[model samples]
Target: MRARTLLTWANGTTLAGLAIARATGATIRPGRDGVLIAEGYTRRIPKNTCFTVGSVIFTRRTAEWLLADERTDLFGHESRHVGQYAALGPLFWPAYYLFCGYSYAMTGSYGCRNALEKHAGLHAGGYDPDHPLRPWAARFRRRRSENG
Candidate 1:
C-alpha cells in the first residue's frame, strides 16, 4: 500500500524469514487496518508471546486478538515496530539485538529497558512502562535472599 508498508514487508521477509516460517499453521492475512496478522502459532511458540516482523504480527491465538478489547492497543504498539523496521532497514535486527542485550544487562529484563520497546510503549504490549531498571547482580541477591 504505502511506501513505508512496502519497506516493512521487505525488511521483514529478508531479516525474519525463520520467524515467519516458525509460525506455521497460523492463518496469515492482511488486516483491514493496514497490518498483516498471523495467528495460531502456539504449536511453534509460547502462548501469549507475540512477535512482529515488520508489519506482520504473529500470535498464538487469533481468538484472543479478536475478542480482547485491550489488544487494540497492541496493534498500535506493533505498528511502531514496523515503522522501526522501515527506518532501520537491514540494520534493524542487529540493532534490536544490541538493544536487547543492553536492556538485559541494565535491568535484568530485556523489554523493560530496551529503547525500541520503550519507544513503542511497553504498556501497550502488556509490560510495565515505568519499571525500575535493576542491576544484573541485584537479581542474584534477590534470589539468594528469597532462599535464605
Candidate 2:
C-alpha cells in the first residue's frame, strides 16, 4: 500500500468504506493508482451515481462505465477524493457532509459552493461547474456593471 493509502486505513476510513461495500454487495476490485473500485452498489439512499469514501469509490453502474473514455473525467474527479480522504482521514466524512449542506443552502446545489467538490472539479463529477451562489453571482455582476 502507498503511504497515503496506509494513512486512510490507519485512520479507519478505508476500513469503513470496505465494510459499506461489503454490506452493499458491490463487486470490489483493484483500480488504477491506490484506489479501490466498488461497483453495482445496491443502495439508493445516496442518489448519486458515484461517490467516494477514503480510497474506495462506489458506483451504481459497472466499473467499466467509469473507465470508459467519455467518463475518464469522472474517474479523475473521484481519485481526487481519495487524496482528500488521505489528508483528512475520518474527519473527511463530517467535513464533507457539512460542506454539502452549506453548499445546498447557498446555491441550491450541493456541489456548487462545496470546497471539496470544487477542488475535485464539479464538471468532472457531473455537477454544474458554473453554477454559483445566486447572491454572490448577482453581487459580482452588479459590481462589474458599476465599474464599467
Indicate which candidate wins on lDDT. 2
lDDT of each: 0.69, 0.88
Per-residue lDDT value at 17 in model 2: 90
Please give, for residues 1-148, the per-residue lDDT of candidate 1 as tens digits: 3776778666664236336635476677665345677776665443446767766677776835743677778777777777787888767788888987987786766787788888888888767766665755578768889999
Q: Compute the lDDT of residue 139 as modeled in candidate 1.
A: 83
TM-scores, in order shown?
0.75, 0.87
Query: C-alpha displacement of 2 in model 2, angstroms?
Result: 2.3
Superposition error at 83 for model 1 (Å): 0.7
